[model samples]
Target: MRGRSRGSGSFPPAINTKAWFIAAILAIGFSDSRSAMSIWKSAHGGVFSMAIRANGEFFQPPVQPICAQPTMWLAALSHPIVCLVRKLELLVALLVFVMAACFFIEMSIVKPPSKEVIRGLFVPSLSGPGATGDTIALLGALVMPHNLFLHSALVLSRNTPSSVKGIKDACRFFLFESGIALFVALTINICIVSVSGIICKNSAVVYGVALLACGTSSTITGTYAGQYVMQGFLDINVKQWLRNLMTRSIAIVPSLVVAIIGGSSGAGRLIIMASMILSFELPFALIPLLKFSSSSNKMGENKNSIYIIGFSWILGFIVIGINIYFLSSKLVGWILHNSLPIYANVLICIIVVPLMLLYISAVIYLTFRKDTVKFASRGELQMILSFELPFALIPLLKFSSSSNKMGENKNSIYIIGFSWILGFIVIGINIYFLSSKLVGWILHNSLPIYANVLICIIVVPLMLLYISAVIYLTFRKDTVKFASRGELQMILSFELPFALIPLLKFSSSSNKMGENKNSIYIIGFSWILGFIVIGINIYFLSSKLVGWILHNSLPIYANVLICIIVVPLMLLYISAVIYLTFRKDTVKFASRGELQMILSFELPFALIPLLKFSSSSNKMGENKNSIYIIGFSWILGFIVIGINIYFLSSKLVGWILHNSLPIYANVLICIIVVPLMLLYISAVIYLTFRKDTVKFASRGELQVPETDKSKVANDSDNVEHKDQLV
Candidate 1:
């Protein structure tokens, strides 16, 4: 059991040896574990990355800034002096810390924030902008999981008791000490944030010095961390000088690469990026620590109590979630703004996105991997039972109501009703929280207003559409898009317009009611109004389907599955629309506001017909649909349709290029979708170019009588002349 707890004790130290261990640590830890080291060498080398981020983005320049006039101390600190400082890392770190500490002391005496401001740093703050993302990112950095590695490595130096009781006593003291340490760390972080709240004249020099201290300190500590990881992971020791030299050399690689590729201005940008990468990998390290600490086999009687386990898991997940958020937001911005060619950006995504998914998969595996469970301490058992009430009720109620084993004597309506209501209230609260977070993101984001509205148009409605019936909104990924609920329900929306257009066309015709039919002016206005409605639908649909296919975060297979299912349905929908438009008979239609009902399906039918009917002289008299109406209607329809086609085509091409699908799958997709597309074009062309065979039966009118058409035109001319005379 103890052998399983740590691999270090099981291996012979001599077998691996110190040099081999150092080599391995350079390979593994510095791959990303030494991300903290990247900042150490890169930022301490440049003195820029430790300063504040403005508007949730890291802003160190691409090149290191050079001063026009150098200070005496700076001039003395040549490349050789810097190299010496890097070598004497501990001495340099302590010296910088002392200098910074002395400066802070002087600042405290000479110029300090008001007492209220100092007091506020310790207290909760609600005054931050609605953009809580950057705040969370900052907090996540301050209390990092990797920081635990540093602490854990340091803890090995202290004497820990072997007995379970003695360890329990030690844990009590550790908890108190940890709280104090965190409080101090948090205070310092807040102080830095507050100071960074405004930019000042001396920002470069003042913050530069502060940044230098931070980077040096991190580097010094990280050197110890590398040593600790080497010994623990490989059961070997290396000389301190050799370890430090190897670590520094490896860390300098990224810095040198950035300096060469991006030039001097982008020097410290590597450190900022490395720091973000560290955040991304932070949860992977934490998941293991949590699992091991929680496992009975590893910790035995000293294993975390249920409270500690629960609390630690929650905290760990929060950190993970923050990293995911940060990664997503940053990745999106980078891809959008990058100067690289589309294919290059795409190549980057193909490589990076899978690696990210793998990272997440690794974390999830570590977190949920089953471990041996044993009896909790008496106090832990009692505490668990006491707190179980709130969490227990929902499942208990669910099982009682749902289980068929209970027969007719199962949970009554009252119990079900209460449980459902309680559940809804809880869900509603969570939805509000989620919405607020999203709204805040959109509001604070760098996107334009139209883009923001586009996001809301896409996200808000889908959420509203699904949230009502979703059993578990946040807990599961597959809620709204089920086989029946998703596939068939999606089609039903398109089918509805099948009922509507006929009812409108037939009722509005003069043959159905010669005197009752709308006047020429009223009829003209109606076409224009419908044209706008169709235009809006086209806008909404393009934003939805295209954006969903291109930008959605769903797995690739899920997207491909959706494309496969929906392409066939869309073809069917187009065929139905073409048949309906030319079909002699009509069906009764139900009409209502689309915003209040299913819309995505209706968009295709609505968009297709608006061009055909409004431009056709046979539907309305030639006088009614003037050149303006025909031109506007056709322009809007074709524009929308063209945009949709372009987007879908581009997306398909991109997907085929980047998809994990095999060649056969790609060939199959192309075969299916391409033919369906050609068929749609044929249907549309046959609909558009086909001569009309059927007439309005009830109307008993073969096309508007020539005399009536001439009379309508004359009436419109007379009305226009009267308006001009007036």
Candidate 2:
């Protein structure tokens, strides 16, 4: 027999993915060593005076520049920017922290040969008010979108044999690589947190002292990572080389200038600015990935399991819900502080009334509406977008949970289940917070009769909407259709690239995503979001838009009625803008100018999908949605559409009525009759037109395509033996 060739037969072992991971971890340690050494050298003297040891370590004691007493003039001049930059650095740091947590949780499931370690990592204290919340938040943040892409691409770097032994070896190597990366990530996070916790704990540390040492440096690291990720994804190799130098220069030059001029204040300002940037930019990368991963067509059999989907949703809702809570709380607190009288508060109740209606409408849409909005554009978008400060971690839940994207190496069932439970607990906490707030608001302002009526009006519709939605989802089938992992991944791949385009064109046009890296939809959505933000900013700056219109709109308080009508619309617009712009991938937005354009584009196509999928006479066979289900879904969907149309039409009608009959603007008859009329007609039309599109086949047996051999067992022998046994 020919001697076994090393290439085909395999030597004991050659190069492995684990080595790369190990190398990366080592690289991190080396970088940390350099950082520490630099700090030490500055303590002894300047960097120029430092010398290296024979063992490749710095001999000088690293020290921060702040230790050297600066001139009063320089300190005064530099403190502002330093404060800003340090704050920005913290935001980036927090974002990265969240990403690391999510990644580790996801990785732990498919990780190799580290069962004891994995168990230790996941063990969380279950006893505190925030223990469950923090864990869920940590997990949500860690399952980052780019990290998912990074892992998928990382695995592709090595070629393995197409045999079982080869696969086993490959898995082992991949795990090691992943483990090393995770460790390094954890180290960086711990260092930052340790530094923050230590400094924050010390009252003597003060603002400038705590920031001077680590502020710009931390931001520099994050900027480097962001730039690296963006450039790497776009395949722009040369840009990375240039960006590495440019980014470091940008960070260091600013710090050096600030040190020379305003000292700590200047550096502080830069850090603060950086923090705000990161906080605001987060939602753009989060929402798209959620929509994508939860999508059945994208994940196929590997799509988010029902439990995971339900859990992640609750978590997302809670996060969004908190923001809403804060908004309401702050508003109420402000009203109380101003000492507004009881009558004014009743006027406030009038505004609150319509908002309750809109809120109910939104809840109904989310719960009962077929998950047909392949891309969310309104309240859901706002909900996801509001979570920008949390960073790309939200999408990680969607990506990591999908087995199709990760192949056989998806998160374990236990992990998915736990993640979901954690998500719900967080939502429950937020609900409690919001409910208590509403109760406080009612008690503080309105009479008992008014309060009870307010509660009934708001609570009844909201409960109905939420129950309807839950009931709908509970009954829907959970099957996804897809072919290959590559195809599945591609469906959601637009998220990363779309995230980059906005940061480029709108953020800094010079830093375009580079090449054919973005789609038309991405560009459109980014601009739309940008404009909406600008609009909101403008409104805030103008007294008439925010303060006057909101606080003093009606005469006896006609402003109150106006606020009730406008606030929800404003919120809806804001939410739509947010969803469109912040998605991981780019989506289309109809400009105020293009409102007609988008409606025309979206309406027909949207209805087409609903019509085809819901129709019983169509192609689904016995797998069709039942007649009852289809009828209910159609009624619900059409009603939702009708509401959208009615909101538009009624608002337009109200505008005409107000302008034409200015004296009658405060008339309750006008408000009640106009809105009620639109609602009645829309409801009637929706009910009449309802029909079931998806239905079971008369033949009874639904056709299914061939799937994984693991999924369905072959029973040819049993089929043949039945006759023999008979």
Candidate 3:
């Protein structure tokens, strides 16, 4: 990670590299010695060691190296120079901002825009030649992909709260801060655009001064961004000064070349080209942020809400769509204008088309990639502690019990007995908790007797299989190897959605909880976690499915079977999970009212079922129901149902409009989809109005059936008396 040192011994290599780079630029810029010498002397205060002849040649220095002294002097000053540059970067940025403001104000005074300018800002329009190019440049300027990576890494420098509430509060604060910053930036941009529109004449001097200040500050920011990007993505740590130097040098060479060849206009064009490159690269950065922020695995309970997820995806697609359109139009225009030979055009298309496809395919892949990083949390830490504690307890207990393993070190009789008792108690509690949850789920499901029997039969074998696997893992020779544990955990974690989705559904369901319903905090947090898990699962599943379908060498029948069977089954499974997430809660306990109020707007589907169940006499028994709650729930349910219908219709309409289909095909789709949608709405309305049929005795009144009286009584005794069913 250490950079090239500035010591006298290390000086030659560094100096030579810089010297060669400068000489190469000079060779390109000036063929004559006098002109080159004059320029060199003007820039560097006449510090050249080699003598320049009248002709365009340099006299070779002696083997003793006359240039060594000045080169060494420059090398010694390099570190301090970089330190100064780093220190000045902030001041330069402030200056740039101030100067930009001043310029905008001056321009506004010189030539003001009308009210129509405001309207134009809100409403996008392309007019005249090069409008698309101008739009591309504007997008490139506003959204630098690398800046996102820089910001992501920069935020990590702050000490973020580990708790859910703290994380949420922090997110809000950041959002506010970002909003303010963006507002200021937007104002500045608007001012610039307005001024540019009003003033037809050039103001290069004013613009250049501001641009130079901006570039100087941006170089520093870019250096830091590059460093963080490397560290975050590649996990490569390098010295900051070295990174800055290398990056600046690389950037300088290209700019110098352009300046020498294309002059100021060429340099300006270079900036535009660079901006376009960044614009194209924007999706790579944006997609990952959207994916990670919205991911449950990476963000845990801090993942984005449904609204944020939807909004971000929409914005992302809009930007991507614009870029695609711009690129395609440009490509088409270029091809048409060039009037190349048919063979050459065909060759160009062959190369470019596949590359474009690859670019699109890559974007699609990135958009769907699962966030695999498992953010550490208190619960996860507790789980790890629980598992590890048993191992430690078992070892200690065995050692204390055995006189052979530790003769003199062995505990006294009472101590050994106490240790064994504690160990047993810990183990017992773990087993009881696990068994209770499993049994609860089995008992709570509204399945038929045959289904319950089948479940038990299947579970028994699976339980045995799990026990065998654990035993094998424990006894294996390589079990203690920890090097690949991270890789192993990542592989295992993909399967976690299976466990997580079910846990969320069951825990959040009052019908399944008997008398021990989850609190509002737990339910809310669990749902967020559940959504993230489901999203990641879908991302991974879809990616793998697509990949397999594309790459598989299976027969057409096998592929068709996969498409018809596996894909549909997966879709159905997902739909069932989603439905369960929205299903009823029988009890109206804890913070149900507060949760209903908070989530009713965003998650009407989940709240609707809960409302229906809680309002039902059969479900809530004799529990008092507030008239206000009942009324609000029904109103909210209807609104939600309406919103869902609207969303579905909009999507269907959007699909129909976007695709180039015949009139009959559009008619056919509308005919088929409209009826299905109506039926769905009808079913939802029916469910909302449906009355509960099952009646349960309140409190102590036992009204059990004859066949299950003993079993019911036994189960009731184990559970709370309030949880007893009639």
Candidate achieving the largest TM-score? 3
| Model 2: lDDT of residue 205 | 19
**Candidate 2: tens digits of C-alpha lDDT, residues 1-726:** 001110112112222122222222222222222222223323222223333222322221123344232212222222334444345445445644444443343233324345544454566345644343333333322333223333443343355565655656666676675676567566544333323222221122122222223332332342333333333333234333354344333344444444346533443344333332222222222333344456665434444568867886776666545434533654566567777798897798688757755644544443443443233447868654543312343245445677756657777899878875665565455455546766786667647786678776988587456545534443444366447866655444423334543564544222333344456776678766656655654365355556676565368457667778877866765565466455554444334545664464345346636655656455665577787877787676666666666665677667766675655564755687668666755554564465655444554355554673434455656664442322
Per-residue accuracy of model 1 over 605-638 as CA lDDT, tens digit each: 5655666666556665444467887678767756
Model 1 per-residue lDDT at 319: 79
lDDT of each: 0.56, 0.44, 0.59
Residue range 1-726, candidate 3, lDDT tens digits = 001111111224443344223222222221111112222221221233232222312223131133223212222233434555435434544855865674685475556656667788888799988777777766756655555655555555445666776667767766875676557667666666666533222443344344434444455445556565555543467776676555544555554455456643554456566666666767766776777677666556788899999999998998888888888888777888896898898898899989888778868876775434354688979866764566666655665555555557778889977876776676567656666777898899999989989988988686566445545443444323333556677666655666776677677566666458688898888878868877886787789898999899999888888899888877886887666566564555446665664454346556657887787777686674778988987786677767767778888989999989998999999999899878877766666667667677766566556769888787778775322210
Give lDDT: candidate 2, residue 649. 68
Candidate 2 stretches with Cα past 4 Å from truth are 1-238, 249-280, 323-726
> What range of 10 consecutive residues in model 1 has the weakest lDDT sum?
66-75
Q: Report the C-alpha displacement of residue 662, candidate 2, in angstroms.
A: 99
Candidate 3: residue pairs that collide: 33-56
Better of 1 and 3 by TM-score: 3
